[model samples]
Target chain A: MIKIEHLSYHYSNGEQGINDISIEINSSTSLAIIGPNGSGKSTFIKCLMGILKPQRGSIILNNQNINKLSITQRSQHIGFVFQDPKEQLFKSTIEQEIRFALRKRKDQKDIESQVETILECCSLTSHRSKHPYDVSITQQKFILIGCALGMNQDIIIMDEPTSGMDYKGIKQLAKIVEFLKKEKKTIIMVSHDLDFISEHFENVMIINHHQCIYQGTFKDACRDETVLSQGEYKLPDIARLSLMAKHQLCTTHQEWIELWKKR
Target chain B: MAQLELSNFSFRYQGSQDYVLKDINLTLKSGQFTLINGLDGAGKTTLGYALKGIIPHVFEGTLLGEQRLNHKVFQEYTHQELTKIIGYCFQNPWTQLSMIKSTLEEELSFSCENVGYALEETRFRVKAIVRLLDLSHLIHKNPIHLSLGQLQTIALGTILVLDPDVLILDEPTSQLDPLTRRRLFNHLSDLKKQGKTIILIEHNIDDFLELVDHLVLLEKGSILDQGSVIDVYTRSLSIGRDIQYPSLTALLSTITSLDKPILNDNDALTILKGVKSHD
Candidate 1:
């Protein structure tokens, strides 16, 4: 479990990026963080990653204060996939990229096999030898995520993983995230892709104006018009359609159809 | 005359065996808002680059085709001349940034300055674009410090400052939140009204369905389908192409045997209400 207490961060320009934010995230669950641009979602993630030390408060993971931990130690517990895959992908080939992190862990004796497993999990076994730049943007993103998974972190935080992806790519990523969840890996996603969020994440935290405005289940977050509006988000299409149909908010098209059939 | 035209267009990067774009033919009238939908690696970005005169010039590719803008051969124009007529916003916002610019205003003004616009004129364009894009609050902030969505807005604003007749945006709203995406589309609508021919490459077609005059679907570097928005969208849906349709369209199609295209939320609601009333 991760507990954040009264966290605050100020930007270099003296702007308050996040203020008095507190939240507790239980292990082995998926959480979606939704907000408008520059609403401190990234800042909060940075604090959690130890990239940016919070000006005030503490972040405790598994009863240990993460603020006091070294960067390498912190990374052992948390893996972050940045919004832009280009920032994290530096290796020549996809296989090398995934192996780069695993080789660093002293306990990862079978790094080659670990890389092979991750490549299979990410559906990139065929493209393992291809240069990272040669693959599509979606594949590049998956490669980075694969690298994070290879690190064997307890929690993985993905920032806008679905942005710029086509429908097929989004579907593939949805499956990968589901696979990760089945493996009991805790996942935190910061995204504006409401469709993906509603379909995958059970819990949600809505950030607005440098603070956590709402935190609840995904269904409640969709139905909460005030929070949605404040966070500058629209309910996923199926959810909105279900709401208009005077039915309970549905996350997926199938669920919406199921509700329609029942009606 | 078509505002922009391409015929028998095909291109392959130097030494590349496979063509990135193949046998593409398209025409756009003045002020038409066209949305190009394609799967990943389907050559949407390459098409945008070609339309912006970056294909044979900057990228150095084997090209086979003819392109014309406003009845003039596009290749005959130099890069500077093309910039005056076409503005291309790349898919990656960071790639379009002028790294030297300190603030959003300066970033927007950098292009105009590069083209040797008068200082006063550059300032005027910057202010107008800022107002149009609702970026007043970020005017003085360093663009590097801004979020991805904010930087995207700045990148687009930089291009808009040039006032080119043709705007080619490759996934401009990919990084934006829903509200900001809507606002960006509204601005695009305004630009469309002002007679700018806009070509957009997008996956999220929900907000753009109504705004788009035409839809072009690309599959594996080839034009799979192109027509009026309704025609292309409905056909794409019927054929089970991996394209995403607006949710309302999908819902209406599923719930009712309605053959007509429902473009927006209100239209879908009305159709749903009509169905309920009959029941």
Candidate 2:
């Protein structure tokens, strides 16, 4: 659904331009891009969204060079959720924001029904009247997702959606992602929450030193010691516990409980 | 003596009808690690500001009780005096940083210059704090251009250079990644061991459960519960309210069926592993 080739772009400050990056994202699948603070992950996503035009490279969406299309035209094919919630939300209420996005391309007769369906799928009906900025960061994220879904864009890119959320909040987001999966909306998320990505996302991409170093299944990529060390990432808690058991630090928790019972 | 104390305190922001904090009573001794846990909009930040004398002073609110820092009544102390005794890092670190600086070193000097510290002493303090936080590499980076994690470290470095008796942070790890969050907590843990009184307003219980000596829960601007870490979790769980313990604690709570629930991450891990062993 999304493709980038030999992409090279630099900031106005003259920092390195993505360093000839090339990658492809399949349709109806999720890809998580992970990296350290300044590894150009955000730059890569922006180029894909056509927010920044790569100086020397081609970005193709559905077999057409995105460089040839206008920003709004590219947005019809790609939807982006920024890292900062405040940047994405300017509407008075949650319903109004989703409605505004729907009104752009949706027919006037079908707008209300489409808005309702997306809001329901995103679990934002209860907060329809509430201002987008007034809601919690977690809820603001869902509101963004609802607006993106309203556009019914082919590919949705989310940046750091789980940075400040608690367990309950993270679970709430995961449930929405699950629904998107069923709806076959291709997803690309930039997350530092390794555990969240490993559990939910099928495909993982590790961007290190301004290059795509690893891309594969979440389980395989996370367990790779090289990627973990280079990206400063850690395995999920369950995987870490399983690794500890291999070292004979301790057996399963159930085994220890049984021994205590006998004692 | 407690570094901070609040007794029967209540506060409601001006122009608001209801109190954001109600009937709060607690004491935090110097050199102890304390965690303040609460749900969204539960007045955790309100209580943090109240402890730092920001409630009635910076934020116009009705105050209905006594608060003291280092045995000095909060109302009796000047804002400068409060700054010396208590260092409060607001939830948003960006707002707290006020200097037009390009580097972390310059940011530290901005604080020192404002306080009129001698040049030699300011340099020494800045170097010491930078080394303490392992921020030697970032000493020259632009504060605005830094990442969220780096900005948090710089914010903390600026505060620690002042050497306040009590350090209160509101959601310090809310914007950091897992790796950065771990590093930040390690720095806090080291500060606690060095006899710095630390108060953290946070929701990431899994990271700090084992380090916190006391746990306080707030709801709708009222003190819902406060006690030792284990006591608060146990009491809340017995009443059927979900305590904000780590995942391991929740799992063990189900297996043991005990009224006295544990909230510490290390304790919960031990218990969960034991259960797994038995089964």
Candidate 3:
């Protein structure tokens, strides 16, 4: 479990990145952080990742303060996928990248088999031997996710994982996410892709104007009209339809289809 | 004139043995908004580069067949001259920044100044673009300090200042907030009305479906299909391929009785309600 208390970060330019924000993330559940562009979502994630030290507040992981942990130690507990794939990917080949992430594991046996499982999960088996840059941008994203999974970190963080991915790539990612959830891993993501969020995440934290405007279930947040203004968000397609339908607030295609079948 | 055409087009990057793009053909007319989409690794970016004149000029490659802009061939126009006619926004907005310039205003005007536009004309165009993109607040700040969304707007601004007749934007709204995405589309719509052609490559063609005159689906470095949005999307879906539609469009398509794809929420509600009544 991870807990944050009154976390705040101010840029050197005197602009506040995030202001006095606090939220608790339970293990085995997904939490999505969303807000307008440049609205402190990334800033909060950075503080959590130890890339940026908070001027105020603290982050405790399993009762130990994350601030005290070294960057390498912090990385062991938390696996991070950067918004830009280029930032996180450096290995020569996709398969090699996953193998590299699995380096810290104590188990000597079944290493190759474990890499195979991760490759299949990421739908990157076909491209295993290919260079990271040779593949599409979306494939690079999966490679990063694959590395994170291979690391076997308790907590996984993805920043804008769905940006350039297409329908097929997204389905593949959703499948892997389901696999991860089954393993009871704590998943956190920051994204502008609302449909993906609506389908996968239950809890959402809305940061706007350098503060947490709302922290609750996505369904509740969608019903709250204030979320739309405070977070500078336009209602996503499914949310808009769900609002207009006024039956049950639906956020996914399956939910919408089921609601239609009822009506 | 102002038409882009390719015939039997293929390209292989200099070092690579395999052709990454193959057997592609397209004719984009003036003022048409064409959307190129497919799954990742489908050579969409390579296709964009081919159309943008970046392929043969910037990247060394084995180019086959022909690419024509207006009545002239690509070789006929110098790289500088091409900028006057075509503005291409890259998939990665960060790379689009002219890092030499510190301030956003200077970055936006770099293209205009480089192209030898008169001082008064450059100022006029830059001002107009800033206003169109709602970028006044960030004009003085260093662009490197801006977020991806802000940088995307500024990157597009850098292209818009050239007053190019055709704009090729790849995933331009990937980082933008929904409202900003809507606003950016609105500006593009305005530009479309003014007779500038647009070629957009994106995974989710949700917000700007109305603006898309043509939809081309790429699969594994080839054209899977190309035509009106509904025809191509529905045809692809029939073959058990997910071409990726907006949530509303996807929802509407689930009902087999719907005559055509609809985007508006109220219309979707009406069609869904009617389907229920018939049941």
Candidate 4:
């Protein structure tokens, strides 16, 4: 479990990133952090990862104060995949890039075995020897995920992991996230893709102006006009169609279509 | 005459035997919202650049066949002239803006300056664009500090100040929240109403189903489909192959089992309710 208590932060230049807020996230629940850009979503993640020192607050992970933990120590408990693939990938070969995360492990043989497993899981075995730049941007993103998984962190935070990907790639990522959920890992996603987010995640947390405004089912949050407007949340096409059907004829999509067929 | 036309055009990057765009034939008229949908590396971007006169100029490629804008050959226009007539906003908003300005007014002026406008004319256009694109409140803030959606608005404003006839945006809403995407589309619709031609390339088809006037699908460097949205959906179903429609289309398709998928959410819902009552 990750717990945030009265968390507040500001940049060194004195612009507030986050205000006094409190939230608790239990394990095994997939949570999506939705908000407009510059809504302290990224800053909050940085504080959770122990990269930023909050001016005031406490971040507790598994009943331990994460703010007091060292960077290396935090890495053991949390994994992060940044929005930009360029920030995570630095090695010549894809295999090496993933392997670098497991460098501190005790056994070399185990590391190699785990690397192969991750490569297979991410569908990157074919390009294991290829340079990171030679591959597509989506592939680069998967390499980053593979590295994060190799770290064996209890919590995974991915920032817009499906950006610039095709529909198939996005679905593949959804499957991967689902697989992670089956493993009971705590997942936090930051994404603007409403359909993808709604289909994959059950919980949606909206961050607006340095405060948590909405937290509940993805469908519920999407229906709120103020939350939808303030956070700039758009409904997925399926949800929109469902709502539209409900509004126009007071029926579900299936029922409406069946009626049209009879006519 | 059509605003832009590409006849039997094929493009192969230098040193590669394969074409990125093969045997392409497309014509776009004025004041139309054309959405190009495809998987990644399917030459959607390649087509956008070709349409906007970026190919064979910025990229070293083997160009086959002919492309014309307003009855003139594409090669006749310089980069500046092409930009003035056809505004191209890239996928990344930051890389598109070159000015180091602290305010919206300054950025618009910088664009005018790059295009060689008089100082007084620049100020006039800057104010007009700021109001039109709704950048009035953000005019004084540093451009770098703005949100992604705001930066997109600024980029559009900069281009609009030039008064381009055709606007081409590559994945404009890729990183934006859904609501912002809707607002941007509303803005695009408003532009369409004002007679601005738009060519949008996107992977998310459902987002633009109702708004896009024409639909084009590219795969492996070739046009797989092209026509009105209904025409494309009918073709996809006719092929007896399950083509990926937008979510609304998929839902309606499942509900209606029709060859022509319903594009509107309200229509789909109404139909769904009728079906439910019958059952």
Better of 1 and 3 by DockQ: 3
* Tens digit of per-residue lDDT, candidate 4, span B1-279: 138889999999888778889999998888888999887778888899999988877888799988899878898989888877898888767767875777778887899999899999999999888877667877887776665566776787777788788989888777776655777778787788878888999876777777788999888888888999888888887776545686665666665565666666566655666564334
Report the number of the highest-lDDT candidate: 1
lDDT of candidate 3 over B224-275, digit per residue (tens): 8999988876676666665676667676676534445666777788776666
Residue B130 CA displacement from its true place in model 2, Å:
3.2
TM-score-wise, the better of 3 and 4 is 3
Residue A2, candidate 2: Cα error in Å is 1.8
- Total colliding residue pairs, candidate 1: 0
Query: Lowest-scoring 10 consecutive residues by lDDT in candidate 4 chain B?
Result: B270-279
Model 1 residue B62 lDDT score: 89
Specify the poorest-scoring 10-residue window by lDDT in model 1 chain B.
B270-279
Interface RMSD, candidates in the order listed: 3.5, 5.4, 2.8, 5.0
User: A6, model 2: CA deviation in Å?
Assistant: 3.6
Model 1 CA deviation exceeding 4 Å by range: A104-113, A261-263, B251-261, B266-279
Per-prediction TM-score to the true structure, in the order listed: 0.94, 0.87, 0.94, 0.88
lDDT score for candidate 3 against the true structure:
0.84
Candidate 4 shows a clash count of 13
* Complex DockQ, candidate 4: 0.46
> How far off is residue A221 in model 4, in Å?
3.8
Arranged by DockQ, best first: 3, 1, 4, 2
Q: Which segments of model 2 are wrong by more than 4 Å?
A: A68-70, A105-109, A113-131, A242-263, B237-239, B251-279
What count of clashes does model 3 give? 0
lDDT tens readout by residue for model 2, A145-199: 7788787787889988876565566777888788789989899999877666766
